[model samples]
Target: MMKASDLLVRCLEEEGVEYVFGLPGEELEDLLFSLRESEITFIPVRHEQGAAFMADVHGRLTGEAGVCLATLGPGATNLITGVADAHLDKSPLVAITGQGGRERLHKESHQALDIVHMFEPVVKWNSQITDAETIPESVRKAFKLAEFEKPGATHLEFPEDVADEDVTASVLPTRPRVRRPDPDRDSLTRATDLVEAAESPLVLAGNGAVRTRAARRLRQLVEHVGMPVIATYMGKGAVSDRLDASLLTLNSGPVGEAASAMDRADCVIAVGYDIAEHDPKSWNPDRDKTVIHVDHEPAEVYEHYNPDVELVADISATLDELRERLDSVEGPEWCSGLRERIVEDVSRKPDADEPFSVKRTLPYLREAMADGDVLISDVGSHKMAIARHFPSYEPNTCIISNGLASMGIAVPGGIAADLALETNVVVATGDGGFLMNAAEIETATRLDLGFTIVVFNDDDYGLISEKQVEHTGEQFGTGLTNPDFVTFAESFGIEGHRPETWTAVKSTLEDAIASDEMVLVEIPLA
Candidate 1:
């Protein structure tokens, strides 16, 4: 027999949890001790939100469900943003929160706020642990649901009493691997017929296509039949931007070169496309184009997104099955010019003497980073530019939050990406977003992690400011101030560089990526 906390930790080990990012508290002291005696490394963070964001990105990069923990009430409340971000982005995550003793849960209690109830809307499943014997099944279920099809966040609330219980429960054995259902025969045949007959057939890939096997078959489908492809922001690297069949990443909803491709195409093969990333209403406002929806589940109900052929099964298998049915097909005639126009809009190099802008910096950043390097973008005006201009050559390399579109993810996400991938990570964040979780710098530095944080110092909330200007012809309540960024970095015991010229920006990024320590490069935007 052992303590329930120990059993809980063992259950986590069985699920292959290597790290648990969280902040410690009084209520969950037993669990913390249990973690110490186990092999799983507990990563304590400055803020619960940062811990949650770290878990969020780790899940997105690795297929496993990233785990996070916190105490009740305030701590659990702090994690809502990142958990919600994971839910909307479809990243698998399992969040755990500690509560008061079971006796006081029904009455007034310290640090108690019905966390299980609060997390209802954001997670797929959530339950409070009342019995020690239930730990094994609870942990297994949390992981299973979070990592399965249409993956998202799940939650568990462990009361203080439950953690101290003595239980003889053993960790559950790993279950047999069950393969996902294959695409239906008739639906797939109909999909092939549409692709074969349509004058212009396009593949609209999303976040779901970035998985290794799915992305491989997607590229094969594009090659076997000369199909045009347009990726949503989160799906940037689903297909290599270098391919002739690639049009461009879908930036804004109804504008730009990518939208033009949607207009020209007669059939849209939405392989692994999630409506939350880029709503079908944006591309199919007219609801006229035939959409061949291929995903793990049936399409979400929407007037504009009605699919002609719903291939509800394994995405990689569906793509391969569809590829086998079609002969050589032709791409849209407008592919060459559409790609060129998209490239020309953002690839121009600004003279060092000219003012800095998001457009000017991307081409240089693209050149500095290798095709395999990872870039996790925090939401702001810069994200729109990165989505539009930055060309990703590999899947899961360029990460973006299109569903929740959360800010302040860049820093925490960078830390998680570095740990998860065991490689140096780069983050693109604006001034507004950087401050949201800026304290994570201490967390990253303490962990001895190597990464580059490129802060676009605009001294304002640029995304909101730009929108306000477009509507009212002026910006209000959008402007803000900042300290000297270089000085700020020095205070944190890390190197920070503020580049005044385009040449300095180019050299700083290259040098930072080469270094084996944390570095911040601040580019002042005009």
Candidate 2:
């Protein structure tokens, strides 16, 4: 006979989970003890929020369901933000929370709450395990649902007493892959006809295109059709910016040449485009252009996003079919002039002499990083700067939280990216976002992971301050007095540097990446 906790661990192992990010609590003692003897390494994080953020990034990079654990009450509550982030971002994750004993549920119990109800709105699926015999089934179901098409978060709760009960249950083996259906013939023909008839067509790539093999096919279709490609923040790397067809990234506002291109395009081929990444209302206010929606799922209905034709199926397969159908059509040169204008605009560097100007600093950082290196952006004004200026050569190399648009993800996200990819990770964060998960620096040091954290130290919430100044010509409640970041990094036994010049910043970044040690760099904003 095996303990239910042991069976639970076995189920996780069978699913090929390599790591579990979490914190321990009284309700999880049995599960923790079981994990001790398993091959999966349990990462004890400083905060439950940090653990969940780590899992979120792990899922985004690997396409696996990143697993996170927590206990009841406060522990479960702390995991909420990251779980919600994963849900909105469409990152696969399975969050396990331990609960008070089942016997106490009928009466008033210490640290007992209906966590299933709490998580229902955020997750794709969620369930509470009330019987020892159900542990294997619950674990298997959670992973499957989490990693399915349109992946998002799932939850499984284990009551304390049930975890210790002996059970005769076998861990279920993972199911074999199932082939997704091909696009409907009539829909594909209609989409192809619309593209052929349009004078100017543009591709709007989003987070859904960031999956495996989808980027390559999307780039091929865009290049073959000779249409300009503009990416949402989360879709930054789907097509390499070096391509002549690439128009870099789109921002939240009405500015940029990309917005101009969107305004001129008569037809929009939205490849895996999600409204959550960037609202359709912002770009399609007039709702006059024809849209061909290509995704694993149907187009989300919005007044501004009613597609003329929906190519609903596996994204890669749909692209391949479209390419075959349009093989005879000559590539259009309609957007070539706009693409050239955008290229020229982004290539011109800002005045490097300016004090810590993000526009000037990011190009140098891009030069320092090698191809395939990972860059994680925290939410703030810097996110806007990096998304607009930073050039990514490969998919999944530049990570941004556009779905939930959450702050405090970059530091822990950098740690997880380095762990999972063994690549040098650079975290770009504003000071306000950095402090939210700054304690994860210790977690990174403890794990002996190598990554560089760059804090854009403005001593204020720069984004909000800029907005306030724009709205009312004044700012308040966003300023802060901060410690010397160099000293702060030293306190955690990591290398820290404050570079006074752009040249010095580049050299410091090169040295840190070469050394492969955890480092922190603070550059005060101009």
Candidate 3:
């Protein structure tokens, strides 16, 4: 008879999970042993939260379900942020956590809590597998649910005793892959008519478009119609950056001209469009305009505004149908004007002495990296600064946590970036944001990833503080006087330095990138 813990490992192998991100614990010791013996790579992270975040990145990069493991009580709670992030961002994830025995679930045992209900609201589905015979089935079901339409995280709680119990039942049967939505021909024809009739047509692709694997087909449809396309923040890399039709790709701030251009379009085609990231009141066209939404999941299609034509089908299939029906469109100067506006916006610079001068430093950074650099921005004004100003010639080179907006995400995210690129990794993080996850610096140094980190020291949470000053006329809990991050990095067995002026910043950045050791460059804002 096999232990439930070994069965869990076997099940993971059967499901094609390549990596398990987690921190081992007493309750999960048996499972950890099983993991070590299995072929799956177990990445032990310093914090359970960081482990979950690393899994989040895996899902975003591979379009497959990310797996995370945790122990009872504190372990499960620590993963809340990352789980919630996956839920909100619609990333497929599985969280297997140890819990108090089934007998001690309601009673207070050491490290005991209502594990099932704790994650119920945030996860798509959650369950506790008390019976050894049922462990395989329950976990398999959790996986299936996580991979379902509008993918999200799923939680499964397994007790230490149950995991060590003998399995008397047979292996659980695998569920067939769920089918994608079928295209409605009538709706497709109507959408095609809308596209053909409109002169200045624009397509807005969202994160859903990227998740659905429709980027290639979306590009084909754009080329077929010869129309310009704009992307939501999470949709930044939906199409290749070097493509002619892609214009003004950034996550936030006023996309005034791009919004105006979208409004001018007689028809707006939204592909796998999820409206969570966009400002509802200001974005999109007037009520009189037509909207054709093509989404793989029907729920996402009508989550916000109702479309004139909603086609529930695979995004690529719908785009192919539209491409076959609609004639080649030539919009005189619509795309050209949008391109010019982007160029103008790129040229816009901040005034001297502004504390938030990260934007001003972008052109030099872009020139320094050229096309090979992989830039990861931490959550803050600095992220917006890089998005608005820094240029990228390739897709997926500019990494961001658009879904979670978790400050201090850059260190771990940058580590992942280094893993992917194996060279030329740069992290631009703000002073306040860096403190939130500065501990990861040690992880990078131990692994010898040696990526360059540029700390933009504004001495405050510039984004929130700036907004509060403007709106409330009072400063709150946003300001800070940072210690020497350079010394901090040096203590962790890494090289550290600070640049005093703009010229120093340029020189330091160039030198840091050239170094073989991990380098930290702290720049004082204003």
Candidate 4:
């Protein structure tokens, strides 16, 4: 017989888990001890929220269920933001929380709460383990649900006493194979019919297209049919930005060449589109466009998003089938002009005098980084700038939180990217968002991971300030006071730089990357 915590760790090993992120607590002592004897690495983070964010980004990058741990009550509550982020962002994550003994659960136990019920609304599935016999099954089900289609967060609460109990239960072996259903023949044929009949066709890609093999297949379909492709913010790298067929990323408000292309197109083919990324009302205002939806599941019903034909199946398989059905048809000549216009719109250089603008900083940052290097953006005005100006060459390399749009993701997310991909990461965040989870910088230093962080020091919640000024012709309650980031980084044993000129930004970034140490660069706006 073995301890329940030992069996739980064994179960995680069976699922091929490599790491677990969390904070150390008395309630988690047994599990932490078990982790010491196992092959899995336990990453001790400064905060539960930072741990969850790390897991969230790990899941997004690796296509596996990233695991995060916490104690009961406050610890579990602190993890809610990142859990919600993983849920809406469609990343697979398993959140484990330690509770007090089951005996005390009947009373007002210290640090005990109904975490299972609290997590129900945000997770795909949740359970509280009250018996040692349920350890293996609970863990198996949590991973299965978390990594399944339309992946999101799953939760399992283990009471301290239950974790200390001995049991004969063994881990269940994983299923060898799980098959995704194919697109219905009638639906595929109808979708093809709609595409072939239309004079002008456009493709709108979303977060769902960011899956492992989906981007390549989608690119093949776009290239074969010679259609203009527009990506939602989450789908920025679904196709290479350098491709002539690629239109740049779209924002919440439809504008620029992309909006013009959408307006002129007779038919819209939505490939793996998720309305959560951007509302259809913003892009499809009239609800009159003939939309052929191709995704793993049926489109969510909305007044502006009712699809004329839905090919619900595996996205890559559906794209392959669509390509096989279509004959070589010459794309419209107007598509060339639209692509040219989009390229021109995004390629213009900022004036040298505008040293403080994001437009000026982004180009230099891009120049300093390689094509496949990872860039993460926190939710703020800087996020908008990165999404609009940064060009991505590959999928999952340019990370941003669109569905949840959670602040404080960039630093933790950059750490995860560096860990999972073994690549250099550059995180851009506004000053307001940076302070939210700044303690994670020490966590990165402990792990000896090197990444560059650039703080856009506007000393305010720039997005809110912009909106306020736009709406009421004045701003209020968005300003902030900040520390000297250079000195702050020095305190953590990481080098820091403050560049006063736009031209110096690129060289500073290059130096940081060459130093092979984590560095922070603060750019104070004029």
Query: In lDDT terms, which candidate is top?
Result: 1
Worst 10 residues of 4 by lDDT: 248-257
At residue 247, candidate 2 shows an lDDT of 79
- Model 4: clashing residue pairs? none
Report the C-alpha lDDT of model 3 over 1-526, residue by residue, as the tens digit: 8888889888888777887878788889889998989998787777777767666666665566788899998999988777877777777889989876677666667878787888988899998887889877887888898877667899888898888887866556676768676688899888888888887888887777777677778878878778777777666666655567776453322365566666676777878776665643345424566778888766343334668888887777888888888887864266676667665565555444444368667755765674757787888988876665565554456666666677766776676556545558888899987887677777677667778888989899988987898999987998899888888888988888886666666677888887767999887777
> Given candidate 1, what's the lDDT at residue 388?
81
Candidate 2 residues lying further than 4 Å off, grouped into runs, are 252-255, 327-332, 350-352
Ranking by TM-score: 1, 2, 4, 3
lDDT of 1 at 85: 96
Model 1 — TM-score against the truth?
A: 0.98
Candidate 2 CA-lDDT value: 0.87
TM-score of 2: 0.97
What overall lDDT, based on C-alpha atoms, would model 4 receive against the true structure? 0.86
For residues 1-526, write the lDDT of model 4, one tens digit per residue: 9999999999999999998999988899999999999999999998899999999999988889899999999999999889989999989999999999888898886777888899999999999998889888898888888887678899999889999999999888887435468899999889889889888888898888885449999889888988878888888789888887787677412246677778777788898788998898877898879999988678998999999999878888898999999865557466677667656655555665665866568767877788878898999998887787677778887888988899999899988888888677898999998999999999999999999998999989999999999999999999899999999989999988998766677689788765668999998887
Best by TM-score: 1
Q: Which ranges of candidate 4 are over 4 A from the true structure?
A: 252-255, 329-332
Candidate 3 lDDT trough over 10 residues, lowest sum: 248-257
Clash count, one per candidate: 0, 0, 0, 0
